[model samples]
Target chain A: MAEIAIILLNMASYVLVLVLVALGLVVVFGMMRVINMAHGELFMLGAYTVVWLQAAGAPFWLAVAAAPVVVGAVGLVIEAALIRHIYRRPLDTILATWGLSIALKQAVVLIWGPASHSVAAPMAAAIGVGDVTYPVYRLLLMAVAVAIIAAVFWIFLRTDFGLVARAVIARPDTAAALGIDTRRIYRASFVIGTALAGLAGALVAPLISVDPQMGLGYLIPAFISIMVGGAGPLAGVLVGGGLVGGTNNLATVWLSPVVAQIVVFLLAIVIIRLRPQGLLGGRDGA
Target chain B: MAPRWLAGVVFMALAAFPLLAADYWTGQLTRYLIFGLFAMSLSLVWGRAGILCFGQAMFFGIGGYVMAACTMGLVGGALTSSYLGLAAAVLAAAGFAALLGYFLFLGRGLSGAYLAIVTLAIAYILEQTLKSAYTLGADNGLSGVPPIDLGLFGASVELWQETPRYYLVLAIVAAVYAALDRLLASPFGVVLTAMHGDPRRLAFFGYHVLSLRLIVFVIGAAVAGLAGALFVAVDEFASPTLIGFGLSTEVLIWVALGGKEMLLAAFLGAIAVRLMESTFAELLGDFWILALGLVFMVSVVLLPRGLIATPLGRLTSGRHRDGT
Candidate 1:
């Protein structure tokens, strides 16, 4: 029972990480219909922001707080400079964002070199969970994930911003005709999505190796989760993250981590095969 | 279409290049020729069929593995022949594409971004799988795969020298270009153009849309596999990067920057980008990526037809325009 409980906790943590990484992507891809290949680069930029701030004598928590702002600003700049121009051409957007991804990665490599950096977890202590003890930092990560999800849900579903954003997504011309600035909505949504990805990166920095290429690892799983979950933000993240993350964690218990990844990919393929619109049955951008 | 006379002239220039260039340059050109072949494969599917495959390296990597396995005698000692290795590489890549396409295109079908994302995922999966597969040398990759050994009857002629190897590669590339050009001008090619233009309309005309897509995908994979096999032969090494996202995106850039609509233009784009990398990557260092990113952005936004293809299209009186 103790082992099972620990496994469940571990699975939850994995699901949270997947959800956090995917939340930003879900917003940008689902709402704007822009396949931002550089989405991972935004995450990488957030991790770098945390690292750079920490190196400059800020506390870990403070650095984490600054990450979303720094990365969000960068995201806005990218949206204005590049993403704004190619919104109509989806395929061209893929190439443009891919170029952005490569450029961001290379810039990081240029600035910090190719070596990996490690960030210390602020809460190093362990907390008792029934019979087993878990790291406080891991527990904090889960709490953060839940808080962010709830926050996003509230903002998108309950707030005026979310209502306008959804309207723009559903019918841009109609939204524009109704006096909503669709362009502003696109820019805002893109920033919010990138900021979420940034926060996720900052939160997870202590647990994984931080490097330019590390974003690719998170990006792939996040993509799998989003695809499996479909385009709907809240339900998609929950179902997709739960399924991909839970299955991967379970596979890790029974098989190798590599095998677990393969299992998740196989599961994604099957999910895509069965539910072409994704498991949650949302409409595709096409 | 480029003037036939211009193509002949260009071929003549390439055929005479070995005579004037240094042996080292000739060797480098050999490698570039293989990349050109890879770019042509991408052009065939992406330009002609409108299927933007972002994970072309998967097929290339499959071919490399098959070539390595066969030449190393890891897969049936009798299959150690270079000819058999090349054949196996093409077949393995095509087979993988057929299976993958069947799953991807059979039902409601995936197009645009969904297809790109799935293909990219599959390529990443293949890279991870190869990295973990100990029999294939894991991350270190397989090395020392023998070069092309053309055995006529009992006697074998190994292409070990620089000039001979260059000539051999050139001959194969020319043959492939000629054959592909002919194939593109056939009735099947017209169907491919129509399919890309309007799949629903083609389906209405009783054409099996899925089968056309699968066939083109398989053909493209086969060409990429052939290129990969040749690459391993020239380099005498095969690594996980051969089948990963990095090379896949690089090839995509090559085809896109060269103008995917024209096979020759795409082929030249690969060579030009590669040559530019060798020169500028050393001088500019990491800033080279920034330049490349700028170029890619500009190409996508301003010159959707490609840098080379735009002028070529105008020069050829828009003959190369495929209604895209």
Candidate 2:
């Protein structure tokens, strides 16, 4: 019973991290139609920021708060420069982002070597729950991921900016003709997308070792989630993340992690074939 | 006048390459040949068929592993020699490609994004599968592959060192290039080009657009497999790198750098990028990816048509060309 509870807790943590990762992709790829292959690397950068801050003798709480801001700022710069130029062509966006991913990964390696960096979780949050001792940092990560998703949901559902953003996605040319500043919305959305990815990375850093290649493992599943959950819908993102994360975790527990990955990807392929639009997606959503 | 002589000259240059170059140069050139064949196969889908495949490595790797198994598998009465191994590898690659391509291409439905994602998934799955199936050597991969042997004439050509492998690679590359060039210049090639432009338009003209794409996609995978077979013969090993996403994307960069439309150009691109990597990576080290990124950005911005296409455009326009 205890082992099962621990496994379930671990699975919940996996699903939580995946949801955060997929949420960012859903925002960027769903709205902008860019695949953002480098999104994983952005997550890596966020994790590294936490690693760097922790190394510099900063308080863990302070580092956690600051890491997202720093990473989000980098996301803003990426949007302002290269991504802005290639908004109309989504495939080109994918290629460009892929290039960015490679460059950023190499940059991370150059700065922090190829080895994985171990980060200790916050001293206060290192608590036990019942017989199953769950890392408080992981629970914190779950909280943060859930909070961000809720915030995004709130912003999209209630805010004027999200309305305009949805309007642009619905009919870009019409929105442009109506003088909605589509480019600004694109830039803003991209920054938000990148920031979300960074936040997920920072939260995940203490739980996993921070390495240059860390982001890549999460990339395929995040993509699968967005595609399976439907592109932009919040519910789809959660469902997609949960399905992939839960299945992958359970599969890994039963089989090997390698076999689990293969199975998940195979499932994604099948899902894609059956529902070209995605499982939870409405008509017109990618 | 220049086109015919250019083709002939290129062929002649390739023909004379084995004799002039030393053993080391021959092997390096052979690797180039194999990569060229692989790149050209990608061109069939990416260039002619307008499918931006981010996962050519899947088919390329699969073909490589199949060849590895054929040569490495010491089952009863099975062929262990490189020649038969290479042949078996090629057939196996093509067969798997036919199956994979049919399913993937069917689901693709002319959506480039969907195709890219699907291919990526296949590559991801296969990569993980390769890691798990340790009998094929997994992460360490299969090594100690013997050189190919000809028939029972007791006069077999083997790649003992760089020279034999180099020349062998050169011969295969030249032959593959010739075949590809001919195929691309055929009426079928023209239809493929048209399909790339507008699939729906071609479908209206009674073309089995999906079928045609599938055919080329399979052919491309087969050619990639052939390259993989040759790769093992030349290098004497097969690692997961041959089928990795990095390698796949690198091939795309090669095609884009050289000009995807032309068969020869893609090979040139491969040589250029690899040569750059060999020369500059020591000095640049980790920043090498930055250079690639810069090159891609510049190419995307300035030479979107590719080096070959840009030069051809200049030549056909009868305009004075700027230094590329």
Question: How does each model score on lDDT?
Answer: 0.88, 0.78
DockQ value of candidate 1 = 0.68
Query: Weakest 10 consecutive residues, lDDT, candidate 1 chain A?
Result: A277-286
Which stretches of model 2 miss by more than 4 angstroms? A124-129, B1-4, B14-22, B73-78, B107-110, B152-155, B316-324
State which candidate has the highest lDDT.
1
Cα error, residue A176 of model 1, in Å, equals 1.7
Tens digits of per-residue lDDT for model 1, B1-324: 445565667678889999999999899989998999999999999999999898999999999999999988999976689999999999999999999989989968888888888888889889999999999999999999998999766578888789999999988888887778878888999999999889999999999999999999999999999999999988999999999989999999999999898888898899889889888999998889878987887788788888888887788684555523
Q: Estimate TM-scores for all models.
A: 0.97, 0.94
Instruction: Give per-residue CA lDDT, model 2, range B1-324, as digits (tens).
Output: 124455567657866787886666666777776887888888777877887888887777877777777767643345666666777777777788778767766744526676777777777677767766678788898898666654444565565776655666777777877787788778998999999889889989999987888788778888888888888766778888778777888898888877776666676778777777877899888788777876776676567657665776566558755533
**Judged by DockQ cut-offs, is candidate 1 incorrect, acceptable, medium or high?**
medium
Q: For candidate 2, lDDT tens digit of each residue in A98-204?
A: 77887788888888899999888775455665777766777777787778889998887789998999898888999999999999998888888888888888888
Q: What is the lDDT of residue A67 in candidate 2?
A: 70
